[model samples]
Target: MTQPNTQIPDFQSIMLPMLNLLESGEVFTLNQVVTKLAEHFHLSKEDLKIKVPSGQMGLFRNRVGWTRSYLKKAGLIHYPERAKYQITPFGKDYLKGKPKDLRIKHLKKMPDYIEWTKTFNQDTNNKQEAEITKEIESQTPEEVLASTVDQLNKQLATDLLDKLKENSFGYFENFVIELLQKMGYGEFREDAAERTGQTGDNGIDGIISQDRLGLENVYIQAKRFRDGHVGSPDIRNFIGSLALQGVNKGVFLTTSRFSESAIKTASDSKQQKIILIDGKQLANLAIEYNLGVQVDKTIAIKKIDLDYFEE
Candidate 1:
């Protein structure tokens, strides 16, 4: 109830108090337990208001939810019915010892816990072991899953950029045109885009229709740099090219970053709406729109179907 700026307790820290609440062996719904734990820890209003990165659930609630899952996996608790939980005989016995903290290390000692974790990749070759350890200790299950996916995507983006730089400038220009079309900029019209393959075509590398009828158009400038930033002079020339073509909207796509002056130049341009997409942003878009990347696999994270057991 207090309004203090304090860090929310990690899921492991919540596990002990959570199991203590269930020691009475009485059934408590998940929400009921969450409310009790929030009070037990005296979580501040600001803390209660905090949410997971996805913003779909409250932070403390997510930690407590994962705490219950860990306890259940460790044979310390079990669902008595849909959405209701009670401490098992093992849970009560463990509480009798008056343990100070219930943690993953404690759970790992249990046979059921060991068996459950066997499904995970047990390879110890990870170079980020220290960081991974810290993450697992402090992050909720949802946070861990999200962090893993983000790291994977970042690595993929780097790889994609390297591969992109290996291609010819003409190929890169055509790729950007197709990328824009795939993103629904040109209404996916086959004849709506064309790459200007000659330097005589001014600074614009490509052009695409904004709509199917081609009433409006977008001028594209694709820069495939091996290294170094695209500077202001290049942006000014692209702007000048757009001005000459009487176009008010353009996309500047690059396989490298843009300098601060370049970004400022585009932002300060009064006559045109300019979007500057860099290497990382371009790679992320490719991944999102499934342009150059294919889905390697999909994971299904599920939960109890309370409605199925309601009867």
Candidate 2:
């Protein structure tokens, strides 16, 4: 009978030395480990990409942080101060009689190392299992779409709440404008002071085309509110301004929120269609368009060529 294949040591094996060095009570920073580990292992800085120390200046900060976190969780290391880490007593004991088989699976049996493998694996498995169950339950296209939209709305509301904490109202307004533009209302423009009427002199903040041409328009009123829901009277005043402009549509945007009555009054009007965008909806739109943000990196994976396998 054939024996099981042995597992090989990888980046984690290389990190063990750095951990050992820290256990010796020598004061060293993440930068010091990056350089020293590279030299001791006879590997170039590029080779250390998979094992650089956490939060250090490099492209591998994420990987380094993961490794550090795992080591700490296993009781091999502890943080002495913010961003400063040191090896534990358990790590020192392991270093004295280090195991010859340095595979990660074998490392779990070390006296100092707690078995986080089972716990971490179970947590990940549970999340994936829940997602699978959800997918199995959502058998129809409409169900899937509805679920996705609901998720989008919840995410938007949560993000808006987070932004409220930051108190960046101007950024929030610009975020809303970008969202509407992305929804194919590209003909929209900020209203001039002269065009703004009572409600307040500059009440209507923007104007959007009902169609491609400028003939039909939808007036917009944006308020950077922090407290209290917009009342029915606010909606009445907005509709009055829309009527003055001879427009059938109006959009009322607020950062705080709108009362149920305000939403009903806006939609209840038989002659006009007034759109109400509260803080929750605004966040959802921002996320959909990816406004004010850009992805910094992308990764692509490819399969090995199979033609050589037949040779």
Regions of candidate 1 where Cα sits further than 4 Å from its true position: 1-132
The TM-score leader among the candidates is 1
lDDT of 1: 0.81
What digit string (tens of lDDT, one per residue) describes model 1 on residues 79-154? 7676789999998989999998778777887765554343221222333547768768898889988988985686
Per-residue lDDT of 9-33 in model 2, one digit per residue for the tens? 2346655666766877666666676
Q: What's every prediction's RMSD, in angstroms?
A: 19.5, 14.0
- At residue 15, give the lDDT of candidate 2: 57
Q: Which sections of candidate 2 miss by over 4 Å?
A: 1-173, 187-202, 296-311
Worst 10 residues of 1 by lDDT: 118-127
Cα error, candidate 1, residue 106 (Å): 35
